[model samples]
Target: MRSKVGLVDLVTRYIIRQKGKKIRPLLVLLSSKLAGGINERSYRGAVLVELLHTATLIHDDVVDNADKRRGLWSINKVFKNKVAVLMGDYLLSRGLMIAVDGKDFDFLGVITNAVKRMSEGELLQIQKTRKLDIDEETYFKVISDKTASLIETCCTIGAMASTQNPELIEALRKYGHSLGMSFQIRDDILDYEGTSSITGKPVGGDIREKKITLPLIYSLNKVSKKEIDSIKKLIKSKNDSVAVKEIISFVKKQNGIEYAYNISRKFAEDAKNALTVFTDSQTKLALESLVDFVTERKN
Candidate 1:
């Protein structure tokens, strides 16, 4: 994957080296195997999913003006914003090329819809953040679009590539969607509970960023109107470290973490239940384990 220019090649290598868990690609392969069998198309599907994921991460870092990713320098941090944006576009185009060259119109449709949903979700979050008005339903909608849609696309593509069973494909899609919801909720929980070393970001990063997640939303609902107003005012303020810490403590005291955990656990359970129709196999077990891992993972 060398480029004609040395700088582009260097940044590409850096990105490859900083790759995260590769969960999307793993879901592609696992779902393919569970549906029927893995083939060249399955491998291509995995590659395309990874390319899409990486491109999104690059763009996200630039959008967030993030300095670090996966505990390493973000592409925008190391290579500057323009180069990072171009590289993200280049990767996205490459992914599209793979789908077009393979004549995988279904996969193309899935990826395009995912990209649209993700963009919409991001814009929605930004809009809500401006008002600090994210409710539980709106938060769920945002996370479903931004995080779960791609995972659903990956599972659907894998099942489509491997088998012709519409039922199986639909089942896997639901499974992926549930798993993705659990995954993101757990990630949000970690923002309040996990260590920076494990999460690769500071605790309460979401609060500092003024992103009202599930825990805070539930906590807000449980508190008095005056307290809720105060919390919103604190979030709308400069979001200083002390204010974020206080908010985190208040959320915990209000049982926000417990409520979020219960909801995430239900989603994880739904994810496991979605695969029950599949014949028992190692792949099925692996997918179930993946559901558990998504909720339990430290990073």
Candidate 2:
């Protein structure tokens, strides 16, 4: 990610300093290893996934006007929105160029379609957040597009790079889809139940953003229209502490978290079940353990 320009180099350095978890690339590597062995194509796929993930995070920080990322000053906070946007664009173009130069046109097509889905998902969320009217089905649609598409694509790309077994590739793709769904659902649950010290985010941040996650969506359906209207008013009250606390308590009283947890567990089980195509191996076990880690992670 080096740049000839001094300012660009400075921004890139700052971004690299805050090392992310690199979970997406790790999944790519693991998937590749499961199929066969890590090769040049596998490395290319891993790099492509990381580059795309990083670009999205940079852009997300700008869109959210978030001051911090991973406990460090966000790119937009330090360098302003223009520079941050350019940096994200730079990463995106670089990732695409790598794919093109490597003649990974199939991978290019999949990733471009994922990017489109991600954009559509984000725009849809923005629209829903404005109205606070997202339903359970729409919630699934948003997470699938916004979060799951890239993850499933990572598995697809990994298998494509390292193996020709179509059945194995399809199995990994299903595993990734289920894993992604469970991962996002757990994230939504954490918003209602997790703490700042563990999750690196304040509780009720989603509520403050007026983002209707599954817990809230499910709870809203169970409550009377009167109670729902009251909670909606509180949410619209500009992040009032009373509003946040009450809505959280209301969701709990309605068993929202428990319901969401059961759903996440179902997806996690499906994720593990999708691995039946692979014979017993350490790589396969690692991938199965990854499913547990994502679903049960405190964050």
Q: In model 1, how large is the Cα lDDT of residue 71? A: 80
Give the CA lDDT, 0 to 100, for residue 263 in model 2. 93
Give the per-residue lDDT digits (tens) of candidate 1, residues 192-280.
89999777789988998899999999999987899999999888778598898899999999999999999999999999999988999
Candidate 1 ranges with C-alpha deviation above 4 Å: none
Q: Which ten residues in a row are the worst by lDDT in model 1?
A: 1-10
TM-score of 1: 0.98
Model 2 residue 227 lDDT?
Answer: 88
- Work out the TM-score per prediction: 0.98, 0.98
